[model samples]
Target: MDSTPGVTIDLTVADQDSKRFGSAPSPIKIGAVRMHGWQVHPISVASDQFDGADAYLVKFNYELGTTPDTPEMNWFELGVELREGVVVDAIPHHTQPTQTSVSYIVNDHLNLVPATNGVTPAAHLPATGETIHVFGVGSSGVRWQYWATSDTGVRWGSRVAWLVTLVDQETTHLDLTTIVRFDQRPTLDWNVLPAVTPADLRIELPTATNPRAEVTTQPANGTTVALLPSSPRVFISYTHDNNAHKQLVRDFANLLIKCGLDVRLDQFASPARKDWFLWANDNIDNADFVIIIASPKCLAVGEGKIDRNEHPGMHCELGIMRDRLQGNRRLWEQKLLPVVLPGESLSNIPVFLQPQAMDRYEIDELTEDALGDLLAAIHHGTEDNSRSPVVLMATSARRALADS
Candidate 1:
């Protein structure tokens, strides 16, 4: 099945929840698959923060009937800024009805009977959504369904929502059933990924304003699995050099974003009233990778050549990074990425990082080869090859000593 095209949602920021209930006053897009009508009950969880809870408990109504078992889930995104340098995700919600859910037997045919890839119980399925197929076990037996959704064209994530009527008010009997056997579905060891930015919301599709639904983007071609892998959090380190160098770094960061990485550059960090030095330290600790842009100005601080009172933010950050690398040899090899700009002398590498293996951008542009290498290094898994650089250096030293 062809993938469903996505609709970008515009999110408005409100200082307070006015309890208004028309068109979703919040920048959040909710409700997918309009049956008859459903209620949006605002339920408080441990924390309303995106990390812990949702804006509300939106219960989709009606049973999976003639409408099409291949249902489209709703895409949601709230643009309200909770704080500086922090981002939230536009989450697509779809699950089995609370009152009724049944397990379906796994069938390997047509990506059905998923022997390995885990299956999620979906109420709104597509007759043909994506290339993969969905099967739900019913009281009688199991059956397959096709589903599809659209892409929002957003670099990170796609956001949209749908609506339906109240099924209870309808005269026809609603059927809520499922066959769910967790162990028989896909494996749970899939990678988890962070959410991306939503697409522009101005685009609209001509459909009955009341009954509509959105679906999650299938993971890949020929297979449908959970969207679990997250982009690594990369902290970009650079000096407050001339606009040219700064622009270069900014462009580099944008390229990383395009390549599916959560870049934490200082400009985007927006330290606000926070102590800039302290902010750098905290950002470094939280980041999965720290990229040090090698330039004359950037190297000055790392080399401790600049006076403490003059401007030590970068210097201080370098100190913190070096200490982190020294303390955790394992993290140093994996987390620290030393990048040099075009025309930068080899000696200009940060004094603390000179001994470390590094990569340089050959041209002024973000080359595919350079980007690929950086990405590979940043997102490398901790498999049998998880040996740190220190370990490799030590082993090489032993070999040399024995030869001598």
Candidate 2:
């Protein structure tokens, strides 16, 4: 039960097909009770193996006390290994042998019982010499086991193959599994998130090569259900000189919400706080996107500014947002769509953001036509693939608006 300690796994990748190749052996660690031990063994060994020929196989062998009428069900616990620079690719394959079989039932009192077996069939399990994808670690090593709250609870996993390219296979594979989960689970609704920077988007664990499978560190404790609420996204960022435009911005954000887009906005700062900058910085650090209400008042710095210990100016938030989005050029572009509300001019726009045009909407000049165009752009920004293209178009529009 305490197989992988402190490790978190995305339940969606359990039982999925994973593939990788290397001459060096990626060691795997496993744990189990008496007579039942789980093992993850690689099938393809190569001074150098052919492309796609390298594979890892998962084996679950356990003894169950057999009894007449009431048979024991096999309870399995497996483990997965990983290392740095390893690229896990999904391979869709489902062919596992059945696990449930007629065996003696071990009663709680360790007495012989003739009761109906409750174990479901585990047919089509991983064959010998097959590459198996791992999800996460349990108590001891990275144990891979079928986990459901109860039989009535649903099980979710992908049968996709994963390709792992290790930078150095000689170091030994870390006794860990990659954590994965779907944006929408337990709910029938299908939610899709843009492929943001994997590193910045989430936290990763360290690798280990020891035979004992010592748990080095605990994975991020944020659960899939917790990190991903039923909402579409998470937002928390700055309150700036655009305070006057708050009403209009909220109106636009409300429209986005009506269209089912999750918006995170903090309308009023706590009147009790003196150091508002630090608090605002922390907010921007966690948000999926930071919306900058670009205006002369927002961008222009007034005279006599000092002790700038930190500031929550629109530009300040933009700088922090940019840092968080350093690598993910695509998601950064998609999530951070600039809105040129009425009275805002693009004359002093920053340099880095100049490449991509901003989504220019003269909210002041709001006719149904302008609103419609703006809505269309916002709609496009909702899709996963729309970041780059949408940012490009928005940038161009902003440029045109500036020129005109």
Against the hidden reference, what TM-scores do the models get?
Answer: 0.46, 0.31
Report, for every candidate in turn, its global Cα lDDT versus the true structure: 0.39, 0.33
- TM-score of predicted model 2? 0.31
All models, RMSD in angstroms: 18.7, 20.2
Prediction 1 TM-score vs. true: 0.46
Q: After superposition, how far is residue 265 of candidate 2 from its true place, in Å?
A: 2.1
Q: Which residue ranges in model 2 land beyond 4 Å of their true spot?
A: 1-239, 268-288, 301-315, 355-378, 385-404
Looking at candidate 2, what is the lDDT of residue 241? 46
Clashes of each: 52, 50
Tens digit per residue, CA lDDT, model 1, 1-404: 11224232222222112211212222222122112233232222233122231222122222221112211221111222111111111122223223122222111111112122365522222222222112111011111211222331111222121111111111121122211110000123311111122332111122235323432212234443332133467888888677567667766775675455656765443112346667888889988788888888777777777776654667777889889989997767567777876655556667667534544433345765667666777667423344543234234323332332
Q: Which predicted model would earn the best lDDT?
A: 1
